[model samples]
Target: MNRTARLYALVEELRAAAPRPLTVARLAARFEVATRTVQRDLQALMAAGLPVRAATGRGGGWSIDPRTTLPPVRFTAQEAAALTVALAATDHGAPYAAAARTAAQKLAAVLPAATAATARDLAHRAAVEHALATGTVLRLHYADAAGRSSERLVEPAGLLTAGGHWYLIAWCRTRRAGRGFRLDRITGADPTPEPAGPHDLAALLRGSAAAGARPPAALAALDELTAPGELDEHRTTGT
Candidate 1:
């Protein structure tokens, strides 16, 4: 499990065992992680404002404060359906797909039967097409701006939709850099058994934004070729 989900599961486990301490060793065994990792996860939970209490001596463990009570979480059927549909939009082959599916199931299990049925139906109808699954290693047949084509092995970082087009941001092994490819220009993609490495997603988005702020070469050339008076006239006339 990922850290976020593990932290949540830890909290639920502690909540279930409230007033009774669960030892670090027990938590480690339960989660199949190192004892030190459980300690770090507890610390993170504490930092996030969870009322987690720790005891250090023999027979001592962690517990949530019994006096603290949380209100029941409530969601409307429409809201539940929307959330399920959103999860269904994730790439089927992505690393997060299993997690997303598990979460959807958990959500359905918590809701009313009728609402759960509606959510399942809505999720079934939603799909994300022609996109590389996130966190997958892909071999792509890519066509570039000048109509040149090349094959590249890339680790998909994420997907973006802008101006009615979809793009894949990936760490390209061929170029040894992060690159964005239009989905339409990628003629083919096949998943590789090798897992993808982590990416600096924020930096990639920033670079994409910066690149987008500049006009295309043809537009720039047009601007340069136009006389000042003609440009002013065109703007004034709304042409």
Candidate 2:
């Protein structure tokens, strides 16, 4: 297993064996690694803010503080499969793609052996296509409020979906400002290899909201399209 996976497994093992320490020798044997390697892993975990305590005396080894640990998360096999498949449906080229895959793997690892297999198979069968334009920099043929078409170069900062419609939050090169574009209004999108510049999405949104300024054409359209109180409900539920 990779070091990341090993670290996760180590934490779980330690949590399960809490109150009674697991000696270095026993942990090393369990993971099939050298005793020194186990020590280093424990050190690394401690450095990363895990409350790992080590004792030198007999009948004492290493243990994590139960009070500092999160409660166990339980998901049925079907729920795990459903969540994994939903994550797979996200845009393939989005920044979170790798993270989503890793998260699914971690979830599977924590599940029962048989259930893990079923969840993986179910996740594999679901797919999403043409979900988002590829790359950080894109050339987009966009329509305005008056139905006037224009081409612009934009650096995609983030993607958000509300009320069943997707919006691309981007830094517009033509306007030299941040804007939100409705995916359906984009007539054409050509991705470039250029890297997108840094953008603070939260700050941008907060600033716009504070100013009570008119939003970009796409966002204005989205506000009109969505049902009343939908955005409020999204915020309340934290979905």
Candidate 3:
């Protein structure tokens, strides 16, 4: 297991083993990392709404509420393909490299026939144009270009491939913003639970562009492909 997956596994294990709240030192001992690293991990977990708590003083550590439920894990073939492409695009030897490759293997094992074929064709024909993917969960202490210091507990939503680059759209708690954060700028990320509130564009904008207006030429061509099945829904949704 890579560092990213190891951290995730550790969190899951600790959450399972502890009867009460755990301290930074205890968690550090469990992972054999510095106290500072455990503290940072705790912040990311808390932001991700893991029901984590921290007490001050010598006895302080991290603790998750026993009542809290684990997050769900499900993905469609297209979603899996997107993730595979995104992972392949990351720096050649990132910390999550081994885990991501393994995930892509698992995705291939589970994909439906037609969907898998489409993904294979796409993967073979198109290269990962940008290398990004900082980590599974960000380190929680980095500042953005705007000089804003922020921490986020983000669920890896679907990966998007557009104009030859990959983007991760997730539910971010710290900014309370469902924003498309560039994977490359991410200093580090760890797998975590999805936050309660999701960022939905339809819900956020509330009809910003004005319906029935003729779309630009680029979007006009999408109508031809809306013959039947789920494709029709995509057209109806103004995709």
Candidate 4:
């Protein structure tokens, strides 16, 4: 689980155990992470506007308001397809995507009979041809696999599902490279914008080699990549 989700889940668990808040030590033990990690999680919870409270002392811990309302829920079939594609792009390590899968299972479990069936059907049939999280510009502090750090201003094009993983294609202003970045390996990213440009979106997406423009044979293989559920089933069925 990602730090954000882990923190939120811990808070929920703590809240359920209500008035019986858990110390950072206990939450860390339960999650098998460090107490320091739990502390950071608490800060994240507060930053996200969750009513998380922490206490210090031999008996004190962390607690959240039981009546706090969470962010809104809005999902379209297109968005769902995009999410599946994003998950496929993860090649298996995007923290939030993993949390999302858990969330999806939980949602499917609690949904009424008809809705559950409809959801499953959507899961099985939805086709996402675009990147999952697009249009959200980001200012990234990137550390290369070798540990070199650089700053990048990116216009996130989309997450591409390729080679059994997800990669983020963005118009990067740092090295002036149209980069395809593995989302999971990224050390950190923050949502922020840079000045808009006169660049053409059509040309940017269509022409970037980061799009992994393919030869005829590779393009043929990609014919199947367009389906949002193909990879999920492959992952689930071990096919």
Candidate 5:
């Protein structure tokens, strides 16, 4: 198993063997890895702020304190999928991204194989949130409604979600003014360490013409597809 998965397994194994310490040698044998590798993994867990303690006497090994850690969870595939999607989508703009990823990994470890794959696929998106939180400047690879492309350096200002679509409200160096770049149309965004001067979200929203033109999320127009009588046309014949 991968290190990430094994870490979760390690926790579970230790928890199960708790009240009775399992030694490094025993842990290595259980996980089928070398003693050194097991040591490294245990170190990693401890570094991640988990309370993995090593007991030094007879019947001693390494284990997580049950009081410090949670018990095992059993989540259905549907529940796991829903959580994975929500976490992945929000991770783009959420704080403590590393913690979020770790939480996802922990859940995936005990989850089904398919859910584990889903969690791995959705793994990190910390850069965007980190840049915003730090008020850093960012270089955006952007496109307009007409598909015209340009690279613009922008001061990270604020984000807006209207009709379920996200827009980055920023002061565009290229435009020499504030603008809103639709999140989906932004092909790439590389954050720079240069400090971003203060730019108010309210001012950008009011001043930027592009902000008004940003489209809603694709599913925002779902009502049109569900308009009255639309589904009738596709019904099977000979009913």
Candidate 6:
């Protein structure tokens, strides 16, 4: 499990064993992680203002006050998907970019195992979107349509998804106009602190609108990517 989910699970574990502390050894065994890792996770939870208490000395462990945490809520598969995607959107071009991802992870932590797995999988779309949202120039090692490679700096303008793929719409400084770089073909991407100069996203979208570029085949792929409980079933039931 990722650290985000593990932190939540750790709390639940401590809560279940409330009134009795579970030693670092036990907690580590329970989570299948090293004891030192559990210590770091506990420290993180405490930093986040969780009411986590660590008992010291021999026979001591960790526990949380039951009154401090909220009760659980059930989420349907569609709701989980929507929340995951929406939180990812907030990570882009929003004031709460960091908090947004944290919230998404916390939301997944509270979900059922199957649902949480699906939500986490979809939330990874943020991994690509994040590079575009830095509002700065980016160093990208990219391969083009014919698989030729080049390294260039780009000013991110926007991003779009279709055909189960994400395209970074940017003003290619070399081209002096907008170009779409498919995310998968972008072997490496690093956002620079240097702020990007103003560029118009509309310029890119205009050509796409004229081309009717996200054609039927691409739209079909989009439908499959977001088709309700299909993801839940596929991940959980393997059907």
lDDT of 2 by residue, 25-102 (tens): 999999999999999999988876678989888898999988887755667877877776666444446688766765
Cα lDDT listed for each candidate: 0.62, 0.61, 0.47, 0.51, 0.63, 0.64
User: In terms of lDDT, which candidate is stronger, 4 or 6?
Assistant: 6
Predictions: Cα RMSD each: 17.0, 15.5, 16.6, 12.8, 12.1, 11.0
Ranking of all candidate structures by their lDDT, best first: 6, 5, 1, 2, 4, 3
Over 40-133, each residue of candidate 4 has an lDDT whose tens digit, in order, gives 8788667655678887887888887777745445565455544543333331234576555555554454344556555554442221112223
- When summed lDDT is taken over every stretch of 10 residues in candidate 6, the lowest stretch is 230-239
Error of 4 at 10 (Å): 13
**For residues 89-110, what per-residue lDDT tens digits would candidate 3 score against the true structure?**
4443467766665556545545
Mark the 10 consecutive residues where model 2 has the least summed lDDT: 230-239
Looking at candidate 3, what is the lDDT of residue 229?
Answer: 22
Off by over 4 Å in 1: 1-134, 210-239
For model 5, the run of ten residues with the poorest summed lDDT: 230-239
Cand. 1 Cα-lDDT: 0.62
Model 6, 1-239: lDDT tens digits are: 98767887898898889879988899999999999999999988887767898989987889899897875556776797668656744533468777776667666566778776655544443444554556777777777666678887778766655456666667777766666776666665544557787776554444232122242331222222222221111111101
Root mean square deviation (Cα) for candidate 3: 16.6
| TM-scores of all candidate predictions against the true structure | 0.34, 0.35, 0.33, 0.33, 0.47, 0.46
Q: What pairs collide in candidate 4? A: 89-165, 89-166, 90-166, 91-165, 91-166
lDDT, residue 235, candidate 1: 14
lDDT of 1 by residue, 92-163 (tens): 567887667656665665566787766654453233122233355777776765567788787766555444
Q: What C-alpha lDDT, on a 0 to 100 scale, does residue 137 get in candidate 4?
A: 50
